[model samples]
Target: GAGLGDHIDRKEGQEHTFQNADPARRQLNQSFAVTDHCSKPLHTAISDRIAEGYTGTTAIRKDAVRALSLVFTGTHEDMKAIEADPEKLQGWLKANYQFVTQEFGKENVVRLALHLDEKTPHLHAVVVPLVEGKLTAKKLLGNRKDMSERQDRYAKAMEPFGLSRGVRGSKAVHNSEGWYLGQQQQAQKAVLSDLPKLTALDRINPARYEEKVQERFKFVSREKTDTAIELKRRTDQVRHAQASQHKAEQEAARHREATQSIAAQLLQAGKAGITLDSSYALLKAPAAIREAANTLFQEEVRKLADTHLKQGAEAYYRGIYQLEDSSKATREDYERHQKHDSEETRNHIAGEITRIFNQEIQQRWGVELSPEASLYKELRKKAADLVRELAKTILQELRKALGLEEPRQQRKSRGLGR
Candidate 1:
């Protein structure tokens, strides 16, 4: 970005400096040399070097590069370490200056400066492309192989200072921030566009509409599996990201298992080849169905949540404490996980609830409950709400399902009788 300038009227205490550092930081920048010969300004010195190097010929082209600019620094941490120690910093500067002077012959290095006020301390050098007493930029610039060997030489020189070559910029990154969200929306809209047109009848019947949507659009998108899974579990992104890798993987695995199990339930129902004309509401159903649901829920679902899921949540935190060292961040994370129903546990609970409801419908009434059915929606809502209530209001030791505390005190304060 530096332009060609043969003259510059520099302010006081800022001569022979090429760095465009902040005016406030100019005091922190050090100019080591500008031509081993005369004490001239930076631009004047640069022009003089190019003129002196040209041996033969016609006027020089205006666009010709007079010198190559080189910048060298190690990793940020390494540079900071050298800066902290005066001995090491001086040695590093010496090593770099020697490398530049040796590489371009002491006479051709027009200007050298060390910048220390920036986040990374680095050396900048300007070298005239003078070879065999003639201006030959190509000879000094060299082919790829020659340039690589030149890099190796510099690395060898800085070896004692623990400086090494930065990683090569060969990979082209294609995506920017929010690229995932854009891609997800595009994929979702593309997939959902292909559904068959709903009839007036279908519009009236949400069950038929929902079943058609489910049957036609099985995947969020088929182009990428990871993206598909991510879109399917979109609500879980923030929780998944802050959680440990092990916890995140557990959630993904549990999700896949629950989905597969629900698919198998549908398949089993289809294979039986029995169908009922309509559905029954679990609460407002015949006395027989209502009584059966409450009794079956007690036996099949509630017991599982009270024992296995609760203990599993507690055991999970216990294992977390054993494996992970104590830290303010980790402890905070553990406490948050305890407070919420973890996605993995949530998925398992939903799957079990769905399984029991499906079994109840198919076995007792020969009906397969579509998600749009009033009975299916009500039962699922009631079951999930029950779990939430227990976790929040907390009944007796059932408070432990959510890692709740102060049950007796809480109860008395809330006016629950003894």
Candidate 2:
């Protein structure tokens, strides 16, 4: 049968012992009591010597019998933690056992005992050849190549638990390059042996292979190349557009800041009780002071408008009660006052003019003084004539700035004249 063999002991009733086994020759050793099927009473002192000797010896005798031993050792602390919660430990062991069984055939594997006599926790697995045979020490215990691969596998398996390979002096196992090469050779042998056979035509089909190669080349050169170029172009376009928009936004923001600063200065001037005429003169002052004066002037105009409206409302209400004969005259007088007598009304109208001036400042770096201002009263009297002259000057400047086109009729007339 290929399954586990029936229990058999070579020593019989005599206690099985290996007190003289060399310690250096043993790859792995730890004390464990036999419990699953076999029972043996071995003295602690003799058992310890056997384990130590097995680890230290190297010589192998001809005709020596081969056997497998599996030892399960448990620490008092781990046993307690596991006993308190057996499901956790049991789950871990079950998964580990499955993995081991897959790696090493289950039939050749054996669990010798589960010992709870130690302070540290561990499991011992002893694997033997399926049939009774002389097991070389190199085979029973792993060689350098086998040990290295075993170590790599162990590290990979324990990675999920956050265990890593340690230094030479550390307890963690290390893998060597030689072990890796051996594993690669073993894998290659297995693969070569298991691969199915194929006919020459089935493996190489020349016409079909040529078609596939051409198709791949066309795909890379045409579709992939075009897509890459388009991607680069789109990326550059997007970056350029973003930069342009950012520049425009920054310029707009700066314009807004400048306008606000001017308004503030005007407000400060109004608060200081400076006459609008005097403030107008300050417009030609240094940039910082000019902005302050403009803000104050604008504020003064708004305040003047509010005052006029309030006063007009009061006068209108009072005039309605006057005698009928005097009422008409009083109403006419009130109307004139509302139209021009109120300083507040003049200031309110001036504020609107100042807003227009600010717009002009943005467009042409120039501000127009309101005709209603005390300093420009004479100009306000001939407003229509003054406006005509100013408009002509503005048109001339605009023509110069824009390089205005000549009228079609004028061009034709000039041609006829010529």
Predicted candidate 1 versus true structure: per-residue lDDT over 1-418, tens digit per residue:
1232211222455432323335576566666754563245556666787777677677777787667666777656889999889999989889888888887888887667777765567776777778886677888778877877887888888888887642233232323213643674577577677766777776788776766674345343533634554444443434444554777788678666655754554566567653322333244344444455556644554454445544444343334334232232344444554566565655455555565656755664445657786656655665565445433432233334435455577679888757
Write the residue-wise lDDT of candidate 2 on 346-410 in tens digits: 44433443444334433432345554666345323333233334333433333444456546776
The whole-model lDDT of each prediction reads: 0.58, 0.43
TM-score, per-candidate, Cα-based: 0.37, 0.24
Q: In candidate 1, which residue ranges exceed 4 Å CA deviation? A: 1-25, 167-418
Q: What's the true lDDT of residue 80 in model 1?
A: 91
Clashes of 1: 0
Which pairs clash in model 1?
none
Name the lDDT value of residue 34 in candidate 2. Answer: 27
